[model samples]
Target: MLALKAENISKQYRLGEVGTGTLSHDLNRFWHKVRGKEDPYFKIGEANDRSSKGNSDYVWSLRDINFEIEQGDAVGIIGKNGAGKSTLLKLLSKVTKPTTGKIFTNGRIASLLEVGTGFHPEMTGRENVFLNGAILGMTRKEIKRKFDEIVDFSGVERYIDTPVKRYSSGMYVRLAFAVAAHLESEILIVDEVLAVGDAEFQKKCLGKMGDVTKGEGRTILFVSHNLPSILQLCKKGILLEHGLLKESADISTIISMYTHNAESEDIIPNSNKDVYLKSFKSYTEDDLESNLQTAKNGVLEFNIYSNKNLKNVKIGIGFNDDMGNRLFTPFSGHFQKMFDLSIGENTIYCTLDNFPLKSGKYTCEIYIGDNTETLDYYDKGLIVNVKDNFTLEKPDYSQGYFIINQKWTNERK
Candidate 1:
């Protein structure tokens, strides 16, 4: 059975010169409510024209969004910031109402869109746990059954009795997530709240979410800036752009479209001109320039070009495993010496040596930045295919990621 459904859900907000929404709009809405009539300005929703750039007008945060989630389906809502992914989740969670359209949900919907959501800062972590669970429609006894596990999962057992206001931003997020995950909610709506946690905690949350969708058979709506997370945890993805639904389908395909569309507009064609940063093409021997794929032990090279009077351009390549873990980071800066190049054009070469990696794909990230900060970033510079390395004895298959050439001796007493 379908757990949740939304049809033509849309939200509009009035923009101000500075701030998150305006109190003036709120007052106008309130005064109109007392008069028992719609506000005359309701027809003039946020304006989009450049002439009215700074004027007070309602802007659509979500427009004509439609989707359905079946039981145990993990749907990822992805788009650039301000694309209404969060607004959609907020409407679904009932934190905010849509300006138009309707939604039907079969079960209790719990959402964790921000840190300390539905939490009382004055209350202790232990108290907030119960409070949050109760707000999610859980009975006291039901929350009691999962209390200990929630505390453990949050890693805040020591401070369970401490006021949440005293906790660090990270601690608040941890406890909030713990309550959201443990409480009995058939439908889950999670925004980028996971991004606040450290790497380990984020991984833990991902595993927990996976368990919820796979083992517990719950429906989930997740929004995230981490594309790889969406690709990993979601079977389906919904793309939203400029308050409109772009597409929804296989997670990988949607993410590819988003990634491509995101970069297509900003990226100038590869040129040999005097600029801050130049674009390099990713290609293979057969001239398959885009989406190049190779078998294990494959060789791929970047056709790098430099077109400025440059010094100290620290060129580097980073390798990330399929799960988005940084496997290796090597840079020319390690050598301390900068490349001396002519003004018009030049090429820098990088080759993957030894290729001990197992059969899987790896993403190469290229960087060209000032010594202090990153000026330009190119993720998925090249996707290299690593074929299986035939070992003499059946591979142990126990070691985690990256072939480690370590010597070990075992002794039994």
Candidate 2:
């Protein structure tokens, strides 16, 4: 059975105004109501496109979004900023009502939408746990049963009796997630809250989320900018573009679509006055379409246009799978090398001897900085595809990240 469903869900917001707007729009809405007609303002709203400037004052943050999630399923919602990802989650969590359409859910939901969500600053950590639990429809007895477990998992036991206002941002999220994950709830909704926590804590939260769906058979709706976490935890993915449902499919396909459609604008100088990364591209030694065969050499070429001569500059490149998981990072500092970039254009080339990456689609992230200051960085710079060269049987995706050259022998007992 489906645990959650959304039908024709759309949220409209008036730009630069609170509530409806001027008295004229209000009167128009009231007149439509008296005439037994739908809200006239709904017709004037435009899609939530951020790239273009629109004339309408009202914009549909989410337009006609429809999807269903089965019980025990973990779904990831992915999109760029202003794509209405948070709006959809707010509607599902009942934190805000949709401007149009309905959402149906099977059981109680515990949401960790942001840092310190549903937490009382004046209350102690221990008290907030019980308070949030009670708000989620958990009885005091049930909360007490899981109280110690939550405290332990959060790793903030010493501050249990301290007021939440005194806690750091990390501590706030740690405690908040601990309460939501441990309490009894059939549906769990998490936004990018994990981004605030440390790496170890994020891993713990991911593990707990996996357990919540696998061990308890609960449903999860996760929204994260961290694609690796989403890919690791979610079996299904929903892509949103400009407040519209772009696609819903398996996690791998959705990730592929997302990466392929990402904006690849050339790096240009902005208000930030530092080293400028003009362009970056990757290709095989033969200058092919950036496609590499297994155990073959490749080249990563990039140009840096600097405003001032840079000394002791470090350049780094990261290889990531389609899901944005960092497979490996090659840094110039690792080789104890630094660049003396003169004021103008300087091109640097790095070669990958016997590329270890297996057959898959990958993207590049470029970083140019020093130990003291950051010059420039580009998260999505270039895209490349790797293919297998040998006729041997291809390994499954889960086997590993690379196909290494190894010699295998069997000895007689």
Alpha-carbon shift of residue 403 in model 2 (angstroms)? 6.0
Deviation from native of the Cα of residue 150 in model 1, angstroms: 0.7
lDDT score at residue 48, model 1, on the 0-100 scale: 31
Model 2: CA > 4 A from native: 263-280, 285-297, 301-310, 318-328, 340-348, 363-384, 387-413
TM-scores, one per candidate: 0.68, 0.84
What digit string (tens of lDDT, one per residue) describes model 2 on residues 87-197? 999999999999889999999999999999999999999999999999999999999999999999999999999999999999999999999999999999999888788
Badly placed stretches (over 4 Å) of model 1 are 17-56, 264-316, 325-330, 333-413
The model with the greatest lDDT is 2
Candidate 1 structure, TM-score to reference: 0.68
Quick one: best TM-score, which candidate? 2
TM-score of 2: 0.84
User: Least lDDT summed over 10 consecutive residues: which range in candidate 2?
Assistant: 262-271
**C-alpha-based local distance difference test score of model 2:** 0.86
